[model samples]
Target: MRLVATPFQRRPAPAFAIAVFLAITAFANPASAATPTQTQPRASVMTVAAHSQIDTRISGLHTRLQITAAQEELWQKVAQVMRDNAGTMDSLRQARTSQANNMSAVDDLKSYGQIADAHADGIRKLTPAFQALYDSMSDVQKKNADLIFQTDHHHAAKKG
Candidate 1:
């Protein structure tokens, strides 16, 4: 018997999903205050918040995956990518903040493109390490890993 692995049939590996989620979070929440004139130390505050969120997500995924000692090296590589991606995004965000008032429309679009490119690059770097870890996983571990990446509604439906 022969089997084929199709894109639709393949679940996102946990590390990749976490990286993607972090990238999405970075873009979705712009460093803007609720009020235009409201003054707060937004840059530092947002940077800390972003790091905290990334740390929490990584911890949750690590626990859910139950990563074995054998997989630790692969996990470390994936974790580093997540941290690097977060730092890059945070730097880009801070740059945007400093130039928010002075940026032209073309410059703004270029900045957005830079952020998008960084996310894509991060995912590209994350995939191989995550695939190695996924390959090391047993059947039960693979199922658990897959579940970690499922949407809330899908997970709930599966549970019910």
Candidate 2:
């Protein structure tokens, strides 16, 4: 059976990159069924799409957060963490996709575990940097940040 409909459901993309940051954990099995030529192109296309999404999300978050000039240094740190997290996610994805055809059920579960761990690790790295930036925000900016982040999780946390 196929487990589809991940990253987001009917929900729109978040104004911030929270969706992208949290979206890295799930992947589908379509690559396992693809021919060599198809797989290569698909992987290449996916790489481009993933990077594009990452860049867009970062820019959106920067704009929506309205980071001040004083916060620029802290913001750069947070942005770097986001980029690092994306790189880590992409690396794990490439590993899993390469091994997809030969994976056993146990291997599949292990791969999922790996992805989850990477997500956790990303949050671990991201939290402090983001927290520093968040700590520096003005009260209005904080409120905006709170609202933007709070909504992004509603769809991600859904059971279905």
* TM-score top scorer: 2
Worst 10 residues of 2 by lDDT: 8-17
Per-residue lDDT tens digits for candidate 2, residues 95-123, read 66666777766656655655566667677
Instruction: Score candidate 1 by lDDT.
Output: 0.57
RMSD of each: 11.6, 7.5
RMSD of 1: 11.6
Error of 1 at 30 (Å): 15
In candidate 1, position 130 carries an lDDT of 83
How many pairs of residues collide in model 2? 0
Q: Which residue segments of model 1 deviate by more than 4 Å? A: 1-47, 152-160
TM-score of 2: 0.73
What residue runs in model 2 are displaced by over 4 Å at the alpha carbon?
Answer: 1-23, 27-46, 158-160
Lowest lDDT 10-residue stretch of candidate 1: 6-15
**lDDT tens readout by residue for model 1, 1-160:** 4354232221221223234433421221122322222321222344676678677767777888999888888888777767767666665556566666666555555555555565676678777878888999999999988777676435433432
